[model samples]
Target: MSAALRADPLADDTIAAILAGYGGSQWEAIALVNRLLAQWQSNADVQGWQAPDGTPAPIAAALQAYLAAAATLPAWADAARIERAEELFFDMSMLSCSLLFCASLPECYVVPDLAGVLHVAGQLEAHCDYRVRSTAAMIFPVMMKGGLASPQGGGIAQILKVRLIHATIRHLIVRGNPAQAAGAAVPALDAPCRHLYDTLYNHGWDVPANGLPCNQEELAYTLLTFHYIFLRGLRRLGLGLAPQDEEAYLHAWNVVGHVLGIEDGLLTHDMAQAEASFAALQARGRQSPFLPDPRPALGAALMRAMQDQIPLRLLKPFPVLLTRYLCGDAARIDLALDQRVNLLSRALFGAGMGLARAIDSVVRLALPGFSICRMMTRIVGYQFTVKFLMNQTRPLKLPPALLNQVGHTVRAWGDDPKAPRWMNALEARLAGRKARRAAPGGQPC
Candidate 1:
C-alpha cells in the first residue's frame, strides 16, 4: 500500500463502525430515514416514535441514539463563533448560492470517478436541475436552523437523511455497478482515484460491512468542496470575511461533516488545516491520467439551469463568467467553460462585481444592520421561489414520488423550445455589446 493509504487506516475503521452502529445495512438505513420522514409528516416527535408491541422502533431507536451522540456540541464548539458564522453566511447569501451552484458543484465533477458515479446514478446529467435544487434545499434547512446542534435544527435531520441516501448509493454502486465502482474504463483524474480503484479491486473485496461505495476519503473531499471551495469563491468575489468569522464558519461545517460521517481526522478545524488538506488533495488529483471530458456538458447544463432563478437576459452570462473567475483557468478549461466567456462578458462581470463591492462597503459603513437586510432579502427570495415559482410548499419533502414528479417537471421545462430562444438572444445581445465596444471610440451606442 502507498504511504497515503497506510496513513489513515483508522478512517476505514471509523466508517465501518459508523455504518454498523447506525443501521447495519443500507436498506436498514433507508428504512430509518423513511420512518423519520413519516414522523415528520405526522408532526410526531422523532425521539418519541414507538414500534409495535410497545417496544421502540428499531430504526428510530438506532437513529435517535446516533443523533443523541452525534448532534451534541463538541468540546471545542463555540456558540459565539457559530453566531458570527451565521451572520456572515446570511449576509452573503447570493454569493453563497452562486458559489455552491457554479463553483463547488462543478469542482466535484473534476474527479472522474466521482463524476462517473454521479452520472451513472442519474443524479448529474439525467436530472441535473432536480439535483441542484435538492442539494440547495438540503443546505437551506441547515443554515436557517443555525448549525446542527439545536434539537429544533433541521440541519441535523436533513444531514441524517442525506447520510442514508449516501449509504443507498454505496450499496447500489458496489452491487449493481461493480465495474464503475472498480474504476474500470473510467479516467483517473488523480492519484486518489487510482488508489481507490486499487483498493476496491486488488485489495480484497468485502460488501456492505468492510467495503462500501462511498468511503471516508470521498466524503472528506466533498466536505472540503463545501467549506474550502465555498470560502475560496467568496474571496474571489472580493467578499472579505473576518478571520474569526472564517474560522467559525469552518467550525460549523466541521460539525456538519461529523454528522455526515466524515472521520474526525479528515475534518478540518480551521483555515490552515483546510488549506493544507486542500493543497494535498489537489496535488494528488494532478497526478491522474484522466483528461477532462463530460465536465463541459455537466457544467454548461448547471449554468443553464440557473436561468430560472435569474431571469434577466443581461445577467445570463454572469454565472459562467463568475464560475470561470472564481474556479480559475485550469478548472474552466477542465470543465469545458473556457470558450464560453467572451471579452464583453468578462468586462460586464468585472464592472458588476466592482459595483456590488462598492455598495456592500457603503452598506457596511452607513447601515450597521445591512447584513440583516441582506438576510431578509434572501429569505423573501427563497420563499418566493419555493412557494410561487416552483409551486412547492416550504420545508421541502423528498419522498420518492415527489422527487419523480420534480424530475419530470424539470426535464419538461428544459425541453421546451422557448427556453433556448431567449438564451440565444441574450448571447447575441452580449456579442453586439462586445462588437460595439470594439468599434470606433470604443462606445456601446
Candidate 2:
C-alpha cells in the first residue's frame, strides 16, 4: 500500500512516454483531451479510437500501441464469473443505484485526500452536474448489458476513457512545472479555472506529500468503493448476496481494477481480505489527512446536492441520515454527516432499518424472498431514479440516443422481479409512480 501511494501506471505507460515528448504544452494536451472526450462521450462502442491517433500528432504509432493494449480485457478475466456478476447487477439494479447514492458515493469521500482532489475538481455542491456525470459515467457503462466483455459494449470503453482521464489530470497537474514530473513534492493552488485540468493542476497537490494526483493506492481504493463498499452496503441493508455471488462480484471488479492499472496485490479475493485491506488503506488516509480538511466541504456539498433533488419535504433530510447509516460513525464524522437530523426522520430511519430487518428475518422463512428491506430500498431508489437520473432537463454532453437508452433502462428498474405484486404496488405508490417507462431522452443520472 505504501508503495502504491507513490506509483502511477502512467509512469511506465507508452501514452505517458508520448505525452512526455509534448513538453507540457496545454494546446497539445487540450487537443488530445478533446479528441479522446469526443470518443468517450459518444453514444457507444467508442472506448478506443478504431482509427489511429492521427490528429497530426507525431507519436501516432505510440498512441496506437497504447490504445490497442489499454482497451483490451485482461487474460485473467473470467467470462462466466463476470456474466454472473452482471446478472446479479441486473437483479439488484435499483438497490444498486440506491447504494451508489447513499453508500458508494459517501464511502468515496471518506478518504480525505481523495475527497480533496474531488472537491477541487468538481466543487460538487455548487455544481451538481459533476456528481451526476461522474456517477453516470461509471455505473451505467460498466453495469449495462455486455458492457465489459463485448467489444461493442460501453463498459470497457468508459473505463478505458476514465483511465485516460486520470492520466490526463496527472499530466495537467504538473503541466508547467517539470519538477513535478518525477512525482517530487510540490504544490500549485493558483491556476485559473479556464479548464478542468488546469483547475485541478492549480489546486495545489504536494505530490510527495499527498502522493500523485490519482496514485495506485487511491485508484485501488476507489475501485473498492464501487465493489467492496457496495457489497458491504448490501450486507448492511440485509440484502447480502450469496457467498458465491459475492465472490463473483469481487472478481468482476478485480478485473476492472486490472484495467484501471491497479496492482494485482491491491485487489482482494474474499470479504475478510477486502475488509482488512479497505480498513488499512482508509486508516492510512485518515492518518494522513489533507490540510484544510477537504472531506467536510465535499461531504456537505454531496448531501446538499442529494437533498436538493429529493422533492419530498419529509424525505429531504433522509440523504444525510442515509449517508450516515451506510457509511457508519467514523465515516459519518469524516464526511461531517454527524449532525443530528429531525426526530421524525430519526424515528422513521430507525424503524425503516431496524424493524424492517427484524420483520424480514421472520418473514423470509415463510415466504422465500420477502424482504421489507428490499421494498423500502426499492422505494427510495425509485425516488432517486426519477429525481436524478431520468430528469431530461439536466444538460449532458451524451448523445440523445444514449440518453434515451439510459432513461429506458432506469424505467425498467421500477419493477422488482422477486417482489410480489403488492410489494411492487406499494413501492410505486410510495415513489409516486406506477411501473411504466419514463419519457425517453432523459439525462443519465
Candidate 3:
C-alpha cells in the first residue's frame, strides 16, 4: 500500500481499494465496511477481522466482510446519517471513476438490466422536476395566491430555479455517460446529454442578474451557488476539455465567484461563505423561515443514538467510489449514479414542500448532525493538500495533470462515469487561463 493510504488508512484511496476487493452491492458494502471500522476502532482486543496486534485486518479482509454482509444487513438497520453519508460518497466515487478513465479506446460493454437503471432514472427525473416546480411555486406566493405581498417574494423563486437547473442538468448528464455513452452507436441518447449541457450553460447566465427581492448580500450568495455548481461540474471532466474552451470557462467561473462576494481566501478555503451569505440574506432583519441552525439539534440526536460510542458514516462520496469502482464493470457505475441522484433528491426534497420548501427541507435534512462547518474544513483541507502535496500548489488553475488523475480515479468507480466528466471538463476548460484570454475582459458567465 502507498504511504498515503497507510498514513491516512481511511483515506478515500484505501477505502476505495477495500471496496473493490469485496464483492457486494456498493451501498451494502459501504454499510458493512463502516460498521466494521467502527467496531474495530472501538475494540482493539478483537481478532479475525482484527489484526494480531489489535489493528484492523488487511484492508481487503474488512472489504470482504462488508461484501459478505450484503446478503444479511438487517432490513431494520437504516441509519439516516449513515445512509446520507454513503450516498454522498457514492456520488463522488462515481465521478472519480469516470475522471480516472484511461483507456485510449472506448470501453467495451456488457448490457445491464436497463429496466432497473431506467426505472431509477425515471423516478429521479420525476423527483427532481417535482422539487424544482415546488420551489418554483414559492416565488411570489402571496401574489400567486392573490394575497398581500410585494414583487420581491418571487426573487427566492428565481434563485431556486437557477439552482434546480444546475441540480437537474448535472444529474441528467452524470446519468448519461456510463450506460448510454459507452454502448450507443447512435445519437439518440446523446441528444439529451447535449441538451442538458446547453441548458446549464444558458440558464445559469440569468441567476446573477435576476431581479430578486434581496439586497446585494442574498444576490451574491445566490450567484455563488450557481457559480460553484458550474465550476465543480467543469472541473470533473478534465481530460476531455479542449484547449480553446478551457480559458473561457475558468474566467467566467472565477469572475462569478468574485462577484458573488467570494474572497480569494474564502473561495480557496472556507467555502461556507456562499451558504453563510445565503443565510444572512434569508435573515436580513427579522427571523426568516429560510434560515435556521440545525447542527446543534442534529448533533444532540446523533450523540443520543450512539451513546457517544460509535462513529457514524462519513459523507465522503469520493472515497467510497474509489473503493467500489476499481473493478471494470459498467453496471456498478449505473447503479451508483442512479442511487446518487435519488438519494440527493430525496434527502433534499423528499419532504413535501414546494420548491422553496424543498430548498428549506433539503437544507434541514442535510444539516441535521451533518456538520457543514466540518465539511467546510475538510473541503478546505483537501484543496490545500491538492495545491501543495500534489504539486498543484499554485493559484487555482486547471491542469491537464490534475484532470488525468481525476479521470483515472473516476473510471475505478464505475462504467458510466462520463457525465460528471463531460460537465466538469467543460467547466475546467472555461476555468483555464486561455478561456480568460478569449474574453475581452474577465467576466462571470
lDDT (0-100) at residue 158 of candidate 2? 62
Ranking by TM-score: 2, 1, 3
Query: For candidate 2, what is the lDDT?
Result: 0.72
TM-score list, all predictions = 0.66, 0.90, 0.18
Clashes of each: 0, 2, 46
Task: Give candidate 3 misplaced runs (Cα > 4 Å).
Answer: 1-127, 130-216, 223-256, 259-278, 285-412, 415-445
Q: Name the weakest run of 10 consecutive residues (lDDT summed) in model 2.
A: 436-445
lDDT of residue 387 for candidate 2: 73
lDDT of 2 by residue, 277-303 (tens): 899889988877788887777778778
Give the C-alpha miss distance for residue 49 in model 2, angstroms: 4.0
* lDDT of each residue in 413-439, candidate 3, tens digit only: 321122323333343342221111222
lDDT of each: 0.53, 0.72, 0.28
Candidate 1 deviant stretches above 4 angstroms? 1-75, 176-212, 289-293, 354-395, 398-445
Q: Between which residue pairs do clashes occur in model 2?
A: 188-204, 389-445
| Model 2 TM-score on a 0 to 1 scale | 0.90
Error of model 1, residue 155, in angstroms: 1.3
lDDT of 1: 0.53
Instruction: Tell me how many residue pairs clash in candidate 2.
Output: 2
- Candidate 2: residue 127 Cα off by (Å): 2.3
User: In model 2, what is the error at residue 100, expressed in angstroms?
Assistant: 0.7
